[model samples]
Target chain A: MKGMTIIVQTITRLVKIFILLYGLYLTLTGHLTPGGGFAGGVVIACLYILLTLAYGRQWALRRFPRRLAGSLDSVGGFIFLIVACLGFGFGGMFFVNFLERFFPGRPFALLSAGTIPLNNIAICLKVAASLFLVFIVMAGARLLEKKDRTYDYKQEEEE
Target chain B: MIQLLPLFVAIPLGAAFLTALAAFKARRLADVGSALATGALLVLAVITIGRQGVYPVGGFLAPLGITLVLDGFSVLLLLIVNGIGFLATLYSISYMERYTSKYKYFTLFLLMIGGMNGVVITGDVFNLFVFLEIASIASYALVAFGGEHEELEASFKYLVLGSVGSGFILLAIALVYGATGQLNMAGIAMALAGTDKHLLIAFASVLFLAGFSVKAALVPFHPWLPDAHPSAPAPISAMLSGVLIKALGVYALARIIFNVLGATPLFGMIVMGLGVLSMTVGVILAVGQWDFKRLLAYHSISQMGYVVLGIGLGMFILASGGDSVVAGTALLGGILHLANHAAFKSLLFFCAGSVEFRTGTRMLKELGGIQEKMPVTRLTCTVASLSIAGIPPLNGFWSKLIIVIATIQAAFTYPGLLVLTAVTVLVSFVTLVSFLKVLRYVFLGALPDAFRKIKESPFFMGVTIVSLALLCAGMGLLLVPAARGAILDPAIEALKQGLGYGSRVLAGM
Candidate 1:
């Protein structure tokens, strides 16, 4: 219930940053490539899940606490909404590509698609936080506690 | 004004997160922010009356990009969903103080409201499914918010059945996409219009009907509703029964059948059949229930039957080339009943919630004589009870009368339809009897010694219930010529247009 062996912890410490970096890369380049916010976010969340498995709840919570994760999720959702609503202030309707004329960057570049890359970033933040929250909520319980697994049923009898 | 259409969905969604973040610091922000958000949406919906337009999301033209349409049907539903939503949020201001995690509750509540708005306005069928899931998932979580054994069990049942329904809906969407190669509603209608009635389309239609039946809690797919509705927090119970079922289930069904697939005589008959079954069966089961909320939940099923029957009769008449005036009358009755039910049903649930809040019990057998203590609740509950029982001059009466008259008129052309007239009356009478039981058991009779100290519900709760009660008493004005022209008639006309909706939408684009 504490954690894994030192070897697994050492390996996770080395690989976690790279995995997070790769997820960010995928999200930033999503407009031009296949792996977008959702896929990239899941990949980023996997890094934390790996940390939890290797180093236990104490170490993982130290890095990404519950409140931080919750805030990140809300912030991401709000940012996405603001970006969508931003188009309304311009000449075009809601969610319009008002940035297209200003940016007008080269095609297929990282910043070529107006508002898409920003949206992808927002979604990446949201999806990553949400996946981590789900894992934490599930694993906060004693995963190996056979008693905890049957906890819900026992409560039913009490009712 | 058309440009503001997307704000209907975006505002609440944005506020959901804002509340989530802000409430972590202040806590009170959640209450103020949610009420303001829903109140803004209500104002927006009112402004939309008698006006119609479409806004393509991201400025992408229809058939290529997602569009938000604000036609009469969408407007009607927006009013019901947002109007009740605002009241529910206000009621929750006082009601939710007893419950922990108030911020989280408001967050999910706003999300549900946003999702329902998105479902109403979206012009694409696939987009409809996505918003439906959003609303459904939010509801599933809210149902289990209490985390009690009963709440968890009810939530699990709802989640499982709801997921199956969503799966069916997704499969049907795939079939429709494969058949028509169109994701937008107008495009799909146009494609389906030219093609013959193929087995693939019929299969998809069947899937849609079955799926929406689950969402609407129709007879065969209704097992989850009774358990889920009563177990949630009372404001949520009001939301679920009042607007969620109508928005996600019946409205979606009507849009698909009338606008996209175009209702044929056979489909109309099948819809009418389902309506009759729910009406008879829902009341029959409801009559035997002692739980106050459960009885109301069953009555939800039964009242939905009236709405569906009215619309279905109109659809049948339209498809069968019967009198156009009669068809319009039937559709009017159905759509009007839909609005009336939203006000009165939520009011009833609010009353139940207030009673439960004060006395800590919803068991009809144990409670009594609280009417002397909570006069506001007693008065509002009586108004709602009268409305639902189809008392004249109240809103429910006018709609029920229109439906009955339509059924009798249709009987001249089709004799079997006469039976539905009698059935509708019988169902109304049975409903009156059920409410009479609720009144006698909960508000009347000797006062239990345990409840003598209870007070009237808090101010916010009383304001909500009273406003809704006033709406219940005054909503018959919607039938007046001036109001009907602006509100009910437009929606009825939209449904009556049927497959022609495709061309109109295309023209708007």
Candidate 2:
């Protein structure tokens, strides 16, 4: 049983890493294509879910605790707000493209989409972390379902 | 103003997504994170109230790419949505302790808030639909959070009707897009300025009215609300009844009718008729409910009707080239009521949650006398109830007075004023009766055998209830001239702009 668990954990970890990388790629390239923060965030969250399913809730919790995810969410939101505030401070309206001056007329490159790419990245991190947290917290509590002891564990075991 | 515009949507959206992810590891993290995020947003909204501008997504101009507008209307809605969202989060911190999955609750709650904020700020019509769906879907899921049979039934009913409403909205959008070949509200308004499609426009207006009215849970379409609202967790019920219908239904409807489509007398009459029907029916239904939350849910629809009637009355006066001041006053009263309702209604729901938390039941008949046990909750509930009943010196009374005055000022005659007055009085009376039933059963009578040890809710919940109760008392200050200029005037001006919104957007670009 231990060996089997190890194999599953190893496989799921690889898969989760792969998914995260893919989500990152999508978020980074969101400006040049249709995929953006929302899609990327969901993808990243799915990676976390995969890990939880394979390695157990405790393992998942240890690696990516709630506090870290929450902090990351705050940071992402702050980044988006700071970007908007920067625009306001730069003598333009809120969320104005202040970076445009530095990258004048740059067309369709990875970094050329101005604030769109940055916003997508911020949104991706926020959504992915928040969603994974929700799933973990919900799934973890299922462990307590049998604690009520309405039915004897021994009786169930005999069956 | 333009730069800060996206923050309205981005902050909440980011917070929601993060809350979902964070809930995976630590359970309590999402709650705290969401509360802080919403608190920041509330402050930001307060700051942005008088500021006006548009932010174009990417580097594209308004007509080419999406834009977020921060006008009076958007800012006013931002304050209500984020303000209520913050309080709900704070309340949930304590109230949700009994629920197994606190993270999921906070995540969905934040998502709904994000969706509402997005709906209010987005300048694109299609974007509005998308955000509305996001908010609506989250709310539907939250309503069924308990996964009980009753909750499932209520959620399923709400989902089916809500999808139909969304379909109607989409169809209306498709028609508008076909008519003007533009999805941005301002751009479409510009396109329609010289068009000879008055009949088509009118048809689309009806479609919009139908769609938004259903979303608002107006009289004829409000069957799902009483079931759904009562089934959700308490904080969620508060959020839903307090702000969800208004944001997706009334706010969007008013924005489209008054600003984008340019309000017509026919449209005004239609809105007024729906308002009158909903007001009469909701209160009548509410008077008979034995469930505490269900009673409040009915009153939500009834109160929303008053808001709609006030706005509709204002539009009627404006369309007929009557007194613009009276029309403006009517609009102001309606919008003020919208904000006031968010405060008092959410407060009522929170108090109900506290009562249930202590007593382990929400059935009015099962509860008997606990006011002495939970003084804070009883006090807050009384304040909220009085506010909703439009008692003197409370927020509700001022807004109701404004609506009554505006109705008479519009020369709707004694009959029209009499009908408005009578319905207003009836709804308030019904509200009082239902709450009195609540006070008598849950607080005033002998303490039930089962609830002898009931305690006040946690500190966070107490803080939230107290804050909202204070707001219920202070909200009348919005009637003051400076506050009106700073907050209410911008929203009214935004509506009065009518199709001129198109010109403003183009000019800003």
Candidate 3:
């Protein structure tokens, strides 16, 4: 797929960093605010989608490959499940808030709620990677279909 | 045993992702990891047969924190889900070779297992819905795994209808919460006990029935199962018909209605009506089908009707203040038939899959006697067929007999029940006739020239299916009082308590 116009590309290049930063901000401060991992993850995915739109598919894929995104998706899920299983170590319960129970992060701070922040971060990685992957795969299919149609039209004209 | 309740969900989920991550390097890891995970679950379910516990997740008490209940009811369901899950995984090792992306298949399979486990063990209403979606979404993906035009179309139909069902369930949960201010099943039971929100409760009850009926594929809501079950791979077909429908649809509805809302005559009547309709309609549809998998799928609907009928009869009896013994008898029949159906139906699907695996076709018209070549499959398929037809000395006959006897016992109290007994017998006869057709066409006819070169399925698939056939034969031994007290009775007791379940759970905690 080809890149967009120079004007659009320039704006996306300028705006991408800020959007990524905002996504991180949302994820890290999820416990203190309304936005959490899922919200932040979507925002981050949007930034990559913007990059894909502004630059070409090849450029975007070179920066963040499908293999890397897929692995990251699994990694995020592992982190989440491991966090839940870790609760079994601190307490017999499957998802007990063991950190808050013993370590007791300060209230109204970034580390409060013990495992909730970690969970949010894990969820953020998962959502962002999965969403980006979904976008690219779907776009690839659409592009393939379009190519097939054009090739068929060329054949018809030749006939 | 109670403390480890979460592992039922955890183990399968962890294996799913683990399979995905590792299979990128070693393509075979998906097979071993998934089988080990489901095997672990089956072992866990086995050891916890008679045990019951209320686990408060995050160490929060009930009515406040999410609870996982491992009562007799859920334990039985856990056994069926993970037990069949282990076998399905084993079967898929050889069976899934025709499909690419083996890891993706295992991943979705494990996710479906985890989701079904969660649905069974959860005591919270909203949590049930979440797990229901998890299982449903995984299944929808698996149905379309083939990526063919027909597969995709069937999957789309399944998805749209499934989402509508989920919407109704969510709306009902909201209504119940609004009325009782409780999301926990027991808490709802307690809060709703004395309340006069009759209309609200009635409306919510109807919504739950409609939603769960759709999931269970009760007649009016059953259009998707025929398409979705057949289009998927054979192992997946077994799972969908064998345990998935029972866990997500019948078991979920049974839990919510009898335990949370308590049994009422009207609820009983409506459920039984749906059951009877599904029975007749499903078999009637099956009688005309030529596709092997499609025929079994229709039989699944019909057999599920038998289960629902028994349970509904129990609910009706208890609600109307009838004899306790009759209610227990009816319930025993229903729940036992569920387990029996799980074994035989999955075995039947496996046999059909084996036929397709060897012959490269599933249509009855395209299949004929290869029985001499595929002796093990022919034998196991015959066993499963007889068991499903309610022939003597097998599990199916015992449960059907119990249901018929219970109906007769109840008929003295309400003469209308005899009519039900007649219908039950008639449906059983129809089931036999259809199986006879399957046997006559596929196994007894002259060997088709096309299948002369065909052979028995792989050793693993044969072993997996034979184990299920063994279960179909030996499950009748569960009727012995000592064994019954351990597994089946507790499940029956769990439902028998009805609204009293609230106090029992809270006190147990």
Candidate 4:
């Protein structure tokens, strides 16, 4: 639970914001460039993972709790679905990209792909939150498993 | 109405998200949410019957854009998935109260439903694989949801085998895409019809058979079923048995072979051979099992065999240019058996769950004289058992009879098929023996002293069991000409249309 050395912690603190900014940049420019929601989300998740590795579990949980991560993950998925359903509602079919038809943002612009960029943001939120949650849960389970093994060893020694 | 095709996938995905978010504090929200979502799907599935059209996702036309095709075949599968899904969710509302993370369960349930809906409805080959993964992953998570040693063990076995199956499918799809230069099913069919890629197509066909037989739990690849089916919670057992295998396994396999790949005699023989092997081996294994759910699990394999037999027979006849009427009869028998098994087998699992719920034991040796104690479960279980055993009046009898008759009629074309007819009858008889043992041991025998205080399952659970029983009894009416014309015949027609489905869908666009 005591995490890594002070140097790692200090570097993570200084470098974390830039990593987050880079992820956001990728997500924002996804439609125009190569990267999209998933790549950006993984990068953002790596930022949190780096922080968790640098700081202790307690420090990380205090800042970004598991419950919040789970809730946010659901919210992200819901938002993505809402975007699709909105297309269905406004247009006659599912995923009609009504935003593009009506607004038709300038080609090669940031908002050019109508619902695509919005969908990327939602996917970004989802992939980041869920990945972080998965890491935390697996980490917690490993800790419990270690405890269980030691407890079994002690019981055997006594018996 | 066709515009709503995407809703089949959307409703459950959205419900899963909302349930995960909102059902944390109010426990009933998960229950109500799952119920309402599946109910809506069931209603949609009913409305979808006898209607055929194509929905282009995001306004993209076929051969390029992803399409959701609604055909007779897809409609039948839609009805099965949503109908059984609704009942399973209802059963879970009570049964899953025992599990602490009810919301998580509901969320996984909805995701699985969405994935299945997507698999059946998608017109693109890759889309089917994606949906198949979604459903498979969710089922894997649910299988391990209990976090017990046995549950984890069963789930791991299932995961490894299921993943292998998926790998084969993905590789086959890659080959298909490479050979045909098409991702859409219609496009592939058209390409296939025009070209002579026999080596490539044949390799993909074998891979499809291997992969889908695993999904369908046909004989050679069914090692995961007995463990995986019984290890999950009971309602989940029903879903895996009654719906999942059929949708992801049988339905997907049949669609590819009949409609997309265009069935061949070699493929037909292999499929029928798998079906026959599964039927014999599954029942022989079941005849000896003392564990109640495990017995039912084995029976799922056997009954799936009957379905495969029917479809395989039809495919063979069609490929060999046998009598069209005989082929149609075989197809009808196979497809109707699929629906019939959905009702009876699911109900049987619920009955097992109920027995487990009250008595806290699934060992047939431990249960006795529960009939007086839980009359509804007892009655429903009896009905389901009779249906599964091919008794005179129930749904199972009608489908099995049709299959046997079709085989007999088909025997004139190929005398070898008479053996298939004989085996089908023999399997039905053995099934009766197995269920008879169940009735004798569990419901009709002396009551154990420890079980004197036991009562029936809770209201929701009993309601599911009874409603399913009603379905089992009345599903025979589906064989009637009028009902068959509306519900069953269209599905057969879809399959009968075969490679024409490609042109039909493209024309719609």
Highest-scoring model, lDDT:
4
- Pull out the clashing pairs in model 1: none
lDDT of 1 by residue, B1-509 (tens): 88689988998898899988889678899999999999999999999998998788887888889978888899999999999999999999999998888999999999999999999999999999999999999999999999877998999999999999999999999999998899999899888885678788888888999999999999999999999999999999999999999999999999998889878899889989999999999999999999999999999999999999988899999988999999998899899999999999999999999999999999999899999999999999999999999998899999999999999999999999999999999999999999999999999999999998999999999999999999999999998899989988889888888878777888883
Worst 10-residue lDDT window, candidate 3 chain B: B190-199
Off by over 4 Å in 1: A105-108, A142-159
Q: What TM-score fits each model?
A: 0.97, 0.81, 0.96, 0.97
CAPRI rating of model 1: medium
Docking class of 2: incorrect
Clashing pairs in 3: none
List DockQ for all candidates: 0.70, 0.16, 0.50, 0.58
List the candidate 3 regions with Cα displacement exceeding 4 Å. A101-107, A142-159
Q: Report clashes for each candidate as comma-separated counts.
A: 0, 23, 0, 0
Worst 10 residues of 4 chain A by lDDT: A150-159
Q: Among all windows of ten consecutive residues in candidate 4 chain B, which has the lowest summed lDDT? A: B189-198
**For candidate 1, what's the RMSD?**
2.7
Q: Write the per-residue lDDT of candidate 4 for residues A1-159, one digit (tens) a residue.
A: 778999998988899999999999999889888899999999999998888888976678789988899999999999999999998788877888988865476756886878888999999999999999888776665312454463111111100
Give the per-residue lDDT digits (tens) of candidate 2, residues B1-509: 45556766667766665665556688767877887888998888878877888777754678878888778888899889988988998888988888887877877787798899999988899999999999999999999998766887899899999999999999999988888788998988898875664777788888899889889999888888999999999999999989999999999999988778777777787898888888889888888889999988999999999999999988887876777888898898899999999999999999989888878899988987888889999999899988998998999999988987887776553245566766767777777877777778777887878888878888999999999999999999998999989999988988877788889977873
Ranking by DockQ, best first?
1, 4, 3, 2
RMSD of each: 2.7, 6.0, 3.3, 3.1
